[model samples]
Target: MSLVRISHYLALCGVASRRQASRLIDSGRVTINQQLATHTERVDSLQNLDICVDGVAVLAPQDKQYWLYHKPIGIDCRLLISDPSSLIHLLPQTPRLYPAGRLDKDSRGLLLLTNDGELTQALMHPDFYHTKTYVVQVDKPLTPAFLTQMAQGVTYQGAQTRPCCIRSLSGFDEGDTFEIVLTQGLNRQIRRMCQALGYKVIDLLRTKLMDVELGCLPENTMRPVSAAELLSLTQLSELTSLS
Candidate 1:
């Protein structure tokens, strides 16, 4: 049987994350064959091995965890604090993981959390150029001229933005809410783009990224990304990376 890193085994078994499993091993909480483990321990997932956590036998590894978190406004996605009320503080105990990209504290919606470095890298890589969708409520009822200009992507805060897809939302009260898809994500990108067009943002929420839709998942809740979605993302990423 091919042996894999024990950490990977831990991740598959749902014991913790690869990173956290390392820490647990270092802290003398993880044991293999009834002996304390080191970070270098090798484990064959299909082989006979005795694993324990804090003296309790570790059950067989489960599938890897990948989740989408519907972040609310005013909470940072990268922090973990004790206050459950704080948006940053509401995370499950697992391996060390961070959000794949930036969504300002003022913005709310789809945020990806994963321990898979390869997947995160694929999403963040500039070459991937994956499309991200946003539902933005701006100050004014959008005009044709303004929307046309936005489609061309005017330069703002330096470099010109790549051409984007825009569709106006009708029947919304007050300002217009639009569906916009962007490839390049500069800092405060949508907000800055709106400002450049003399529009003020009332609410901003990410609707989708690549094949991963924010879905109907409740606020501040998370769920694993589906296999089909993951395959699509990975395929797109690989194509771009190879090109």
Candidate 2:
């Protein structure tokens, strides 16, 4: 590859956006050829520059990159500048990248982080209908009729939600909680779904996206995605074709 700005190189490295990489450059975290990079510096990968995150630099790759972040309640899914007190600020290597999709402030769970712009766009496009699963708690008891309406779909803000798969894990006289999966993401979808059914939302949490599940992951923790997950998401993307 020809030499280019470090920010541009970072964007192509699949670690983050050009805008974000600039932040790293300003923070003095990104290095070029084993040297700490000053803002506006440029280099070429074939020239053998070592890009580091934190203090440990990485060997940048052309392969697509992915990361899994367990967002805690109150954490905004949108990327932010490093604040010593912020949740994602603890990232060993900070980069500029945005969330694949949004999660409401009150809700929390798995969220995907990626640097591939085309892949991010394809996965979030409305026509692709990427499936998202969430666990929702309601103030009212689960009724057979309620489940049916949600399954059949309901209108929110004048637009109707696509029919979704709803499973009632339990329903007591006091309240009901269910797991619902939907392909479309409308703002406050789970909450809106309950309100449409004449129910009030108590809590909502996303536990899975496509094949990636939160499992026993603790909140605020993050790690590099496994090779298997990378393969699965790629395969799923191919199957859906994002067409």
Candidate 3:
């Protein structure tokens, strides 16, 4: 293997993102062959190098694993200090696994977890335009105008959101329920869009992302993604890369 930058190597090992890996090196938490490593250092041979992050050895996984997790509301997607409610702690005690995309603490539904950093980068990259679908409940009945605005793209904080697909789900005991599909994953995007239209989101649940669906998986549980699913994901990544 060719010599790779420490940050990129660390990212491939699932220790952190490239930027986070650089920060780790600068903070003196990373060591190469038992000596403190610098952000500019490169690993001549991944197999021969002894890389450690905060005393934990960093090694790339031989086989990347992908999982579909039904994250429950109130559980954080990222690891939290001393917090068992985090997705990291909830997952099996395996190294190098990280969430592909995040669902805020108040939101719940399907979340993808994987050890493949490259795949994560591809799926999360803005250029990929991966679609994510959500089932949302709002405090008021949705007007045709509201739906139109959402589908046509609404301006938020001086920037217009990308056009999205929106449909009303039949039968809601309270408030209005709608299915929204977005190609962009903005921070608290669904909630913010509703807020901008004078609607308060009471509950938000992500139902699908790309070709993966939440299905009937129990909350707080996870299972390996199927081979067919992985193929679809990889094909999508390849298409994005070419584009």
Best by lDDT: 3
TM-score per prediction, in order, is: 0.69, 0.70, 0.87
Q: Deviation in angstroms for 61 in model 3?
A: 3.2
What are the per-residue Cα lDDT tens digits for candidate 2 across 68-181?
888877775544555433444545453544566778778888888776644555567678777888988888789889999999999878989899999898864554889999
Arranged by TM-score, best first = 3, 2, 1
Candidate number achieving the greatest TM-score relative to the actual structure: 3
- Cα lDDT of all candidates, in order? 0.76, 0.74, 0.83
- Estimate candidate 3's alpha-carbon lDDT, on a 0 to 1 scale: 0.83
Off by over 4 Å in 3: 17-40, 171-175
lDDT, model 2: 0.74
Candidate 3 structure quality by residue, lDDT tens digits, 1-243 = 668888878867776656566778889999988999986787764465688988978776446788999988999887764777777777666655778889999999999888776677678877667999999989888778888999999888876799999988854334399999999988888988888889999999999988899999999888999998999898886786587
Q: What TM value does model 1 have?
A: 0.69
Clashing residue pairs in candidate 3 (N, C-alpha, C atoms within 3 angstroms) = none
Q: Where does candidate 1 stray beyond 4 Å? A: 1-64, 80-88, 171-175
Query: Number of backbone collisions per candidate, in order?
Result: 4, 3, 0
